[model samples]
Target: MVTPFQVHVHLRRHLMKELPETDDAVAQWCRDQFVVKDGLLDKHALEDTFSDKELQEIRRPVKSLLVVTSWAILVSLGALKFLHWSALLSSWKGIALSAIGLAVVTVLMQILIRFSQSERSTPAKVAPAKPKNGGEPSETRQNKEQ
Candidate 1:
């Protein structure tokens, strides 16, 4: 989600610097790929961006996250049940514990997902090598020669 959203932001920034023709192209792409409606996304337009394989790749992590989150919730509930049965926590304490547990799980999940996505989002930048003769790059010189 973060990766795709970041790409969208980058594309928007790119569009701002481009010419009107380029702007039209970018706008068309955005219209086809994303559907924003009343400050929310339109599900059908969003689905149009990816093919079946890409959708499956996205679904894999989401499914995993759901499973992990469910497990975390269950564990938190189990802990609360234990605390209740043992009388180790008062009502306020139980509520506090549940809130803290939920917060921790949500934060950790976000951090882990963001970390994983970051690696894919940023590629190593390679500066073009300067020509030894120092006029223009060899490719440009070659084009002039022809």
Candidate 2:
């Protein structure tokens, strides 16, 4: 059996060879696709499977949430149909109230984040110094006059 260290070395070379050439555009492309694998013996192991297709594959579940949530609501209401109206009122009341609370909290969070980001740096502090006029202060003037 191949040792893990040897396997890691093999993977690392494979990753480096597969990386785009060191031109700016290609490097940026690689940066988006490739992450530095720190744990392996050859730490910079880079493998394939980075692309728009990969991202879409990853995002499938998130994109399906709208469809899933709709179906969930339909199923729940179907089960609720045999129940009394009071059951419906009690079951969904908290969900509706929580949704409203979430909206209000989200708006407040956005306002707080915007204000925090917009805060400007305070003006730099100036060192205190004796005020000077057209002539140097007398204590210093005699030294200059000499």
**Winning candidate number (TM-score):** 1
Candidate 1: deviation at residue 115, Å? 2.0
Clashing pairs in 1: none
Q: Please list the C-alpha lDDT of all candidates, in the order they appear.
A: 0.63, 0.60
Candidate 1 C-alpha lDDT tens digits along 1-146 = 45543222111244555534564687786785455432233433465442233332224667888899999999989987887796646677876876797799999999998987845457779887555767687888888889
Taking all chains together, the TM-score of candidate 2 against the true structure is 0.23
Question: The CA-based lDDT of model 2 is what?
Answer: 0.60
lDDT of 1 at 141: 82
Query: In model 2, which runs have C-alpha deviations exceeding 4 angstroms?
Result: 1-95, 111-118, 129-136, 139-146
Q: Please give each candidate's TM-score.
A: 0.28, 0.23
**What are the runs in model 1 whose C-alpha is more than 4 Å off?**
1-80, 86-90, 121-146
Cα lDDT tens digits for candidate 2, 2-104: 7564221223244667767856768786665454533332333354332223232224566589899999999889656734443534657856865686699
RMSD after Cα superposition, model 2: 18.2
Q: Count the backbone clashes (under 3 Å) in each candidate.
A: 0, 0
Cα-based lDDT at residue 41, candidate 1: 34
Error of 2 at 124 (Å): 1.2
